[model samples]
Target: MEDPARLAALETLRAVRQRDAYANLVLPQMLRDRRITGRDAALATKLTYGSARAQGLLDAVIEACSDRPLSEVDGSALDALRLGTYQLLRTRIPSHAAVASTVDLVRAELGSGIAGFVNAVLRRVAEQDEAAWVDELAPDPDTDPVGNLAFTHAHPRWIAQAFAEALGSRGEPLKLALEADDARPAVHLVARPGEVSADELAAIVGGDVAPYSPYGVHLETGAGDPGDLEPVRERLANVQDEGSQLCALALTRASLEGTDDRWLDLCAGPGGKAALLAALVGLEGGELIAVEKAPHRAELVRKLTSGLPVTVEVTDGRETGFVEGAFDRVLVDAPCTGLGALRRRPEARWRRQPADVGQLTTLQRELLTEALRLVRPGGVVAYVVCSPHLSETVGVVADVARRTGAEQLDTRTLFPEVPDLGDGPHVQLWPHLHGTDAMFCAVLRRPV
Candidate 1:
C-alpha cells in the first residue's frame, strides 16, 4: 500500500505545481481529507514544506543526477524526485527507505518506465549527503561568497543579494541573517488583552513568554496547527508574529497630544494586528476603522474582530474616505513582497521575483502618504511591512516623509529594550538578531 503521508505530500506538491496553490493553505485540507494525524501528519508537514523551501537546492541536485534536463521530466515525476531528494539530503530518513518509498509511489502513479527513471535519479542523488552535494554543486565561495551562501541555505541568488544589501555587510552578518531566515520560526501567539496575560496564557498553553512583546508567547517549533490550541479556539489568543505585535503596539506608544482613542489599521487583512489593535483601543473606549481593499479579506477582518470596537471597510487605504486629520493613531502595515517572513511561508522565497518590489513599493508609498494625511497633527503613524527589502522599508518611509514633511521618530524607542537595533531613526528587526520575523517599522508624525 502507498504511504498515506508520502501520498499527501505528493498531492500537496502537485497542487502547488499545477494550480499555483499555496503549500501552507493546501496541505492542511489535504491532511484533513486523508485523516492524517500524529507523527504521520508531522512527517507529511515536514516533507511538503521542507521540499518546497529547498526547491532551489533540490532541483539543482536532481538535475545533476538525472541524465535528462528537468524541463523534459514529467511534472509529477519531478515532484516525487523532489520529495525523495529532500528526504535523502535533509531528513534522517535512511537512503534505502527514501529511495524505495519514492520508487513505490512512482510505480503506483506513473508505471514502471517513469518509476525506473525516478529510481535512478534519486539513487544517484542519495550517493551524496547535503554538505557533499553543496561542495560539488554550489558556487565557488572565494569568488562568489553571497551566491555560495545562498546555494548552501537554499535561497535564490537575488534574495541573498537583497539581504547582503540590506545588512550593509556581505560577510558573517549576512550569513547569520540568511541562516535564521531559512529555518522555521516558532509559532507565536498573542494573548488577547483583558482575556489573558502572556504569562497566564503561556502556562495554559505550555509555551514560553516571548522576550519582546508582553502579549506574545512562543510555542515549540512544529507545534502543529496553532488553531488547534484551546486558547486560540476559545478566542483568548491568536497566532501572530512577535515582530508584528511590536509594530502594532508601537503605533499606540507614539505620544499623541489629545484624543488618543481614534485609531486606524489602514491595510488590515486577515486581521492579526487589527484584532490586537481593536482590543487595546476598546480598553480606553476608543474605536478602530480597519480598511482592506479585498472583500474576502475584509470579511476575515470582521470575523476576527467580531465583538471588538472595529469597523471593517472594504476600500482602498490610499483613499479611505474617513476624512483627513481624524484618527489619533494609524497603522500602515502595507502590503509587501513578504520577503521577511519567508520561513513561515516556505513557497514565498521561490515565488517572489525582484520585479515584484517596484509595484509593492509604489503601493507602500501611496499607503504611507495617505496615512500621514489622515492622522491628526501630532498623531503618529506606524508604517510597517513584513519585508526588510530596503525599497519597501527605508526607501518608502524616506520618500514619503520628504514629500509630506512628516517628522520621523526614532522607532527604536518604541520597541523598548530590544537590542542590536543598529543606528536607527527606523527599525529593521532581523531574524538572526531578534528571533522574530524580519519585520520593519518606521514611525512618522504629522506636523501640528
Candidate 2:
C-alpha cells in the first residue's frame, strides 16, 4: 500500500482540481474522515497545501520533463506526477524514498504502465535542484520582470502585475508581497469583547497577542484546529485575520459627530466581521443589521451572532431597500477576488483569473453605493475589501466618492498605533509589512 499521508494528499489534490473545491475546507474534513492525526496529519497537510500552492511551477517542470504535453497525460497520472514532482523539487524528503514511495502510490492507483511513466518523469525532475530548474524554466527577469516573478513565486502573471500596480512608486514591493503570500500564514483568532478578552484567548490557545489588532491572537499555522478549541465553540472567539479585525475596528473607531446607535454590515456573510461589529454595537446600546444574499451564509451569520444584539437578514445588499438615512454607521466589507488572502487558501492563486476583477468591482461599487445610501448624513460608511488590487481598492472607492460626493476620511488617524502606513486617507495593509492579509479600508462619510 502507498504511504497514507501521500495517498491523502493525492486525494485532496484531485478534489481541488476536478471538483473546484477549496483545499483549506476539503483537507481538514479529509483528515477527519481518514482518522489521520498528529505527525501523519501534519505531513499530509504540508504535502497537500505545498503541492496546491506550487501547481504552476510544478506543471512547468512536469511539462519540461514529460514526453507528451501535460494535457495529454491521464488525469490520475498527472495528479500522481504533480505529487512526486512537488516532493522532488520542494521538500527535504530524500531522493530514493520520495521516488520509491511515489512510484508505489502510482502503481497502486494507476497500475504498472502509468507508474513506469510517472517514475521516468519524476526521475528527470529530480535531476536538478529547484533553483536551477526555475532558472532554466522561468522568464528572463531583465526583459519580463513580472512574468519572472510570477513563475518563480508560483503566482499568475496578472496577479503579480496587480500587486506591482497597487504598490505604485514604492520600490519593488511586488516580490516581497509575492514571497509573503507564498509563506503559510499563521492562524489568527479574535476574542470578542464582552465575551472574551484577547489576553484570555491567548492563554487558552497558548498564543501571543497580535501587535496591531487589540482583539487578535496569533497561533502557529498547524497548531491543531481552531474549531476544536473551547473558545471558538463557545463563540467567545472566532478565526479571523488580524488585518480583518483592524478593518472592522477602524470603522468602530472612526469619529462620527452625532447618533451612533444603529449600524449596517452590508454583504456580511460567514459572519466574522459582523460578529465583532455586533459586539461593539451592543456595548454602546446599539443594534446591527447583517445582510447577506445567500441563505446558507446568512444562516452562518445568524449562528455566529446568536446571543449578540444583531439581526441577520437574507437579502441582496446591493438592493437592501433600507430607508435612505436609517443607519448611523455602515460597513460594506464587499465581495472581492480574495487576492489578499492567498496564503491562507493555497489553491486560490492558481484558480483566480484577471477577468474575475471586473465582475467583482461592479458588485463592490453597487454595494458601496447602497451602504452610502443607508447611512445618515455625517455618518460613516467603511468600504473594505480583502484585496489590494488597484481597481478594487482605490478605484472603487474613488469612483463611488466622486459619484456620491461623500467625504473621504483619513484612515491612518483611526489606527494611530500602526506604523509605516504611507500617505493615505485610505489604509492598505500588507502581509509582509503588517503580518496580515492585504486588506484595504477607506472611511467615507455623507455630508451633513
* Per-residue lDDT over 42-112 for candidate 1, one digit per residue giving the tens place of the 0 to 100 score: 99999999999999999999999989999999999999999999999999999999999999999998999
Candidate 1 Cα RMSD (Å): 0.8
Clashing pairs in 1: none
Q: Which digits, one per residue and each the tens of the lDDT, describe model 2 over residues 375-417?
A: 9999999999999999999999999999999999999988769
Judge candidate 1 at residue 171 and give its lDDT: 93
Question: What's the true lDDT of residue 435 in model 2?
Answer: 96
Off by over 4 Å in 2: 169-171
Q: Which candidate wins on lDDT?
A: 1
In order of listing, the candidates' clash counts read 0, 0
